[model samples]
Target: MAAGIMLFEQKGFSETSIQDIVDMLGVTKGTFYYYFKSKEELLMDIHLRYIEALLENQKRIIEDSTKTIKEKVFEIVYMLIHNIEKQGRQARIFFREMKHLNEDHLKKIVEKRDLFRYNLQLLIEEGMRNGEFRDDLPPSIATLTVLGAANWSYQWFQPDGKLSDFEVAKHMVSILLEGIEKK
Candidate 1:
């Protein structure tokens, strides 16, 4: 599965063949088939694992009673960056190769993605209720602003870069909660 994910990340998903995975693992076709019915199934497994992990982490952050909503939001962003640093390869494959999954698989992935969005929105709503965030702005817009900035970090953020994940999260939180342009 790791080998398949690596291949999918390096090479485009459409370019990767089931034979490539079996050959890379030095296993027989029967062995590969025993584990995964098809390459699509393998990709789905990767997506499922990634989403489940992220959801678990988010749940932990949300359920932490000690933290303020502001703190929880920052923690969520930091967790995202931290997880990406820990699983850079899998994250790459999970995000980039998702398009290769068929319609049914894509639908399920979309549902998971929506769950993430909904969580973000809930955080925004909580912040608004608590007067920690700008209540004038719609919750959806704030949620998208926060989520978009955090999610797009995967495109440019380098784990080994000068700034740590928490640092990046701080920057994002500043821009998101504090706004970019001066008051």
Candidate 2:
């Protein structure tokens, strides 16, 4: 899986071959076949593991009672940005190569993805109810805006950049909650 991820991240899904994965690991073709039916299956497993981890983390943050909804939002954004360093390849592959997945695989992934989005929208609705976020923004749109901004960070996030993930997350949360207009 590690080899597959690295190769996928470096060379992309369509470009990387099963032989390349086995070559990286010094393993036989049969060894790779033993665990995965094909490269697409391996990619599916990798994507599933990544999204599952994210959902679990997101749910955990949502369940924490001590933090305000705003704080939870910060944490969720922070988690996504922070994961760039922790799970860079998995994320890049998940976002970049999703179109390659077959119908069955895509459907399953889409279901999980939609569930994540719905939960996020619910969180925004919760914020609106609690007056932590503006009620007039429409929870669904607000949720999509927040998620789109945060999730798009995968395209540009850098572990070695001037700002750390924490700094980026804080800045994003500020703009998201407070807006660019000066007081």
Candidate 3:
């Protein structure tokens, strides 16, 4: 799968072939077939693994009673940014190659993605209810805005760049919460 992710990241899903993956790993096509019936199935596995791990981590963040809603928001953003550092190729492939997935696979992945967004939206709504975040903005929009900013980081963020993922996350969360207008 690592080979597939690397090749997919470099050559794209449609461009990548089962032969490419097997050749990269120095394995037979039979080995690949043993695990995945098709290349798309492998892609589906990647998508499931990525989103499921995120949901699991998010469950932990949401369940932690010690953190404030605002703190939870920061943690969630940080988590997304941090993932770029850990699984940068997977992140890139996830966003870039999703269009290749079949209808049923796409539907399953979209459901998981939407669940992640809905979970964050619920948290934002909780913050608004508790006076942590302003109630003026719609929670759905706020959730999408946060996700857009963090998810888009994969496009430009460098793991070895000047700014660490933590710092980027902090700045991003600050900007989202505080805005750029003068005080």
* lDDT tens per residue, model 3, 23-100: 999999999999999999999999999999999999999999999998999999999999989999999989988998
| Models, CA RMSD each | 1.3, 0.9, 0.8
Look at candidate 1 and tell me the lDDT of residue 55: 90
Cα deviation at 43, candidate 3, in Å, is 0.4
Per-residue lDDT tens digits for candidate 2, residues 57-91, read: 99999999999999999999999999877898899
Residue 7, candidate 3: Cα error in Å is 0.5
Cα-based lDDT at residue 163, candidate 2: 94
Off by over 4 Å in 2: none
Q: TM-scores of all models?
A: 0.94, 0.97, 0.98
The global C-alpha lDDT for each of the candidates, from Candidate 1 onward, is 0.87, 0.92, 0.95
Q: Against the correct fold, how does model 3 do in TM-score?
A: 0.98
Which regions of candidate 3 are displaced past 4 Å?
none
Best by lDDT: 3
Model 1 Cα lDDT, one tens digit per residue, 84-111:
8888878888778888888999999889
**Backbone atom clashes (below 3 Å) for every candidate:** 0, 0, 0
Displacement of the residue 98 alpha carbon in candidate 1, Å: 1.9
